[model samples]
Target chain A: MERIPILRMGDFLLVTIQVDMHDELAMTLQDDLSDRISKTSARGVLIDISALDMVDSFIGRMIGTISGLSRIMDAQTVVVGMQPAVAITLVELGLTLPGVITALNVERGMSLLRERVQSE
Target chain B: MNVLRSGTQAVRIEQDVVLARQTARKLAVEAGLRLVDQTKLVTAASELARNTVVYGRGGDMDWEILEEERRKGLRLTFRDQGPGIADMKLAMTDGWTSGGGLGLGLTGAKRLVDDFSVESAPGQGTRVMICKWT
Candidate 1:
């Protein structure tokens, strides 16, 4: 059982995805994030996917689900560092992930998450 | 019977579909496709590969590297011998799904590749082919 480490930075949680994601691993991340969010009572989550070069329909849906779950748990999730290629693919797959927020990079995403959390 | 031939990457399990995406990406990059094209092809491959394993109950995907006078292309064909799709028109429709999914795999894969084709029957198997040129 492989695990993706979730790092805590201040009141925010940071996750950097580096593997070629499979269905089980993606689901594991969702479960791990949900538990971490409730346990730490984190205000925001910043997911950096710069190392992930590919995203499929399943992964796209998983992302949307994660963000929606985080919102219910009172945490704002901001995904950042999406490559141009991955963006194009997501659109083509008709998965805009309307429920999730995105930013250009980790710095911007962290700021955005903070702003959203503060506003909430 | 779904058999793996030489050079054919068989995607019979969930993990195989993940490997399929990796193989597609590597081939797309080796074909000199741009970053966006490579990503699109890889994504499409993932969707189709998952379909083969999930809906079709297991299948194999074959990779072909093509070089024409003008461009080089990578083509992938996914085949399955399980209960085949009965309605091509309905299956290709966006938001229409026989299985539990976003219902975007068939239609979305078509949009991402340069060439796409599907063949299936109610009792026969399904074969989907897609190619991207650079």
Candidate 2:
């Protein structure tokens, strides 16, 4: 089975998406991430999608769901490294990802998560 | 349809949706469409393909590379023989969902393309067609 790696980075869990995501894969990631969050009790989650060429409504909703789920578990979630074309396509797809935080890149995303971790 | 090249793929299985999206992207790129345009077309394809599998109970996704004088475009058509939607108006409305989704699939796909059309009947099937020009 193809699975995305989740690395522990201090109090944060980092997920770097390096391939195109299909429906089942996205669902699997959501399940895996949620379980890991409970086990590690991480303070934050950062998803890097720089390698993703597109973000459809399904993937967009998956991102939103992951962030929402993390928030309910007392973890901050920030998606980063979205390409310009993806950003445009997502907006046009009517997936604003309300309540989900976003950043320019992984570095900025970490700092954003750190701020949340510090405040909490 | 003024199609220069056309092909059809089955959308019965989940993996077929991914192939549909790839076909749309490749056709857009080969047509020399812009990056943003390619992404938009691919995104639209993904939504429609998923709908065909999940809501339409599996269907067919067809693609065509189009040419009209100097204009070049890619067109995709999704058709299914499942229980068709009764209310087209409600279905097209954002946030109106019958499949536990964000209710953005049909409406969102429409926004990502240059030309869009939908046809359905209660007992008959449903068909959605979209075109993106370069």
lDDT of 1 by residue, A14-96 (tens): 99999988888999999999999999999888888899888888888888988999999988999999998899889988989
Error of 2 at B30 (Å): 0.8
For model 1 the local lDDT of residue B32 reads: 86
Deviation from native of the Cα of residue A85 in model 2, angstroms:
0.9
Q: What lDDT tens digits, residue by residue, belong to model 1 across residues B1-134?
A: 12222268989999998899988888888878998999999999999999999999999999888888778888899999988999999999998988878999999999999999999998799999998988
For model 1, fnat equals 0.95
Q: Please give, for residues A26-90, the per-residue lDDT of candidate 2 as tens digits.
A: 99999999999999999999999999988888889899999999999999999999999999989
Residue-level lDDT for A40 in candidate 1: 98
The residue-by-residue lDDT of candidate 2 on B40-102, one tens digit each, is: 999999999999999999999888899988889998999999899899999999989998888
For each candidate, report what fraction of the true interface contacts it reproduces. Answer: 0.95, 0.86
